[model samples]
Target: MTSSTPSSPLLPAFGVGTFRLKDQVAIDSVRNALDLGYRAIDTAQIYGNEAAVGQAIADSGVPRGELFITTKVWTEHLAGDKLIPSLKDSLTKLRTDHVDLTLIHWPSPGGAVPVAEFMGALAEARALGLTRQIGVSNFNIALLREAIAAVGAGAIATHQIELHPYLQNHAVAEFARSQGIHTTSYMTLAYGKVLADPVVQAIAQAHGATPAQVALAWALQLGYAVIPSSTQRDHLASNLKARQLRLSDTDLAQIAALDRGERLVNPEGLAPAWD
Candidate 1:
């Protein structure tokens, strides 16, 4: 795969995420997101819904070239020999030969797989045309450093992380930015938690937007790509409008003050040492 120009955005500024969405529900959600003008879709091997997402993509009637699909390789498949084959399986399930970007879903539990092994394998997968770009998710500053060392900064495309107002993760985001690795904010709405925050709601009311839109806009304005998932058509459509909702300086500062380092996705045995 060819490298992207430096000026090109690493990923879509706004996209749809498919976590916990399954079966026909995943299909209808993806299909509806497409109809509402969402071009980027995020999924994972562990999500167990790639086939459903694939079916939705197939039935959407949208040309493949117009879409940007991203999927992750589970930690169990990080071995050098296993990575590519596993990604191939993901491709078959996603109904595509190549994904726009492929990421290490999380660091190997307890560091069982060395960073070089999986990063090199991911690089190989990109070279083999299985994915156009490669990246890592849920990595802290130290892990990001190790990932950059393993793959070289230029080989990395982005760092997908849990970055909502409540869990700003400034250290990791700052490190990624300093190295030119774009940050993709997952759970930008904080699993609906931020949607109910008084500050977020106030900002939304002031902008005539929903709290979800305000949250997404805050992340986008900070130059981090956001994937906010929704199963509702109205919510999906409203989320996309965030690209048009520009927050004022006060609004941005107010949301920034809401950061409390509250992380919502840490699995006891799987989470890394956060930065």
Candidate 2:
């Protein structure tokens, strides 16, 4: 776990993601993950599974203090007046008083909302005990700079982005590093695409591990926190073991050569200009 500052919330290196999951599927996935020793969970307002995730958490009987819960505010809620209120609404759905981390889901749908306005409101949310820390997702270099200007560098705890072997996103990752902001690599497995790569498969064979574990270990070795999602209990349990699958320099290099800038999360209007 790491944080940009002393007061920043501690973010675990691995967690379960609830992106496309919903209803009973989300509940079962989250419950299975928690039961398999996963202590962190990532969800967002747009995911439409916050309440299900909340229910899974309650049913697991995991103490709130031992878990790190993260949720994101959608683009519609980026306005200064709406940010905090929407987060409160998210809190209600999550069944928690405060989230470990809260991120702006995207950069205000083409910057219609100024970074300062929402960042200030998010900081206010942290100050008011609604969230322990604040961060952003899908922000590019320019947008990250604007956010850093709105709140000091240390205030932005983590930058969640679409990163994996195919789309390494070195520039944004480097910039985040220079600012001391932790990077969360969403889609770290490239949504199962990379799991079939010959290079990844070879590495998996050499390590005697699953391809999913190899991909996750690569991201973990690069210092990025990963929240890989899986509905199957076997996959969830297997993915958690990635933390222990250390990659050698040669293995890392083999996977690094697989980078081809193949991004998979770009949307028509919501995605920003990528770095």
Candidate 3:
């Protein structure tokens, strides 16, 4: 079913997440999401789905400005020369002149180019008009501070990180809030684990929502943008209601108490000291 939301410069806080989807699958999934009223689509270099995501965008008939597309440069490609080229390649794949936002996938330490250099290249890309907004993903409090110190807040916009009821992330969330930095909560549903949690289910029953909606609502209430992925049309359709589900103060606290700092995809070899 197609859907849309009231206009808010702040993103919908609910979007499509394409992480493990492959070529043809990504394309089909994206088209489905678009037809279903999802204006925001998230992709990354590591996801191996840019080409498919691009294809879907190309055929969706959605105005470029209307759709908020986000793509990222992999940690391995954070070098000076690689930065622009990688972005160019992503643009080529997405079939767009520019993306809504381009992010540094990881703050790899001692890889090749310094974070400052990568951030500089990102700023240059923004100036070049290849990307409207530039930001970072998988960044922690220290890296957030480093990026702020190096590039300033005006350049780096949001920090995309793993946040869910199971991983409260209050520290980073509060810090970003104070810095006027918005957060995009990837894995907002805890990769489907939240779907099975008795607590989440109970909360969902109380609000007449799915468990995913409850978890997503928890993060949204905490002021973090959420992107919950679902290959199933039913789940995707139900997830949109997450934005409308407003949990109470006590409910929010109960969810926050579930934090265990669990991580889903670190790949420390790709980013040493990733924790």
* Candidate 1 per-residue C-alpha lDDT over 13-91 given as tens digits, one digit per residue, 9 for 90 to 100: 7789999999999999999999999999999999999999999999999999999999999989999899999999999
Which rank order by lDDT, best down to worst? 2, 1, 3
Which window of 10 residues has the lowest lDDT sum in candidate 2?
Answer: 1-10
Candidate 3 residue-wise lDDT, 220-260, digit = tens: 76667777777777778888888888887777767767889
Q: What is the lDDT of residue 234 in candidate 3?
A: 73
The C-alpha stretches of model 1 lying farther than 4 A from their native spots are 1-10
- Residue 153 in model 1: lDDT: 86
User: What's the CA error at residue 52 for candidate 1, in Å?
Assistant: 0.5
Every candidate's lDDT: 0.90, 0.91, 0.81
Give each prediction's root-mean-square deviation over alpha carbons.
3.7, 2.7, 4.1
**What is the overall TM-score of model 1 with all chains considered together?**
0.96
lDDT value for model 3: 0.81
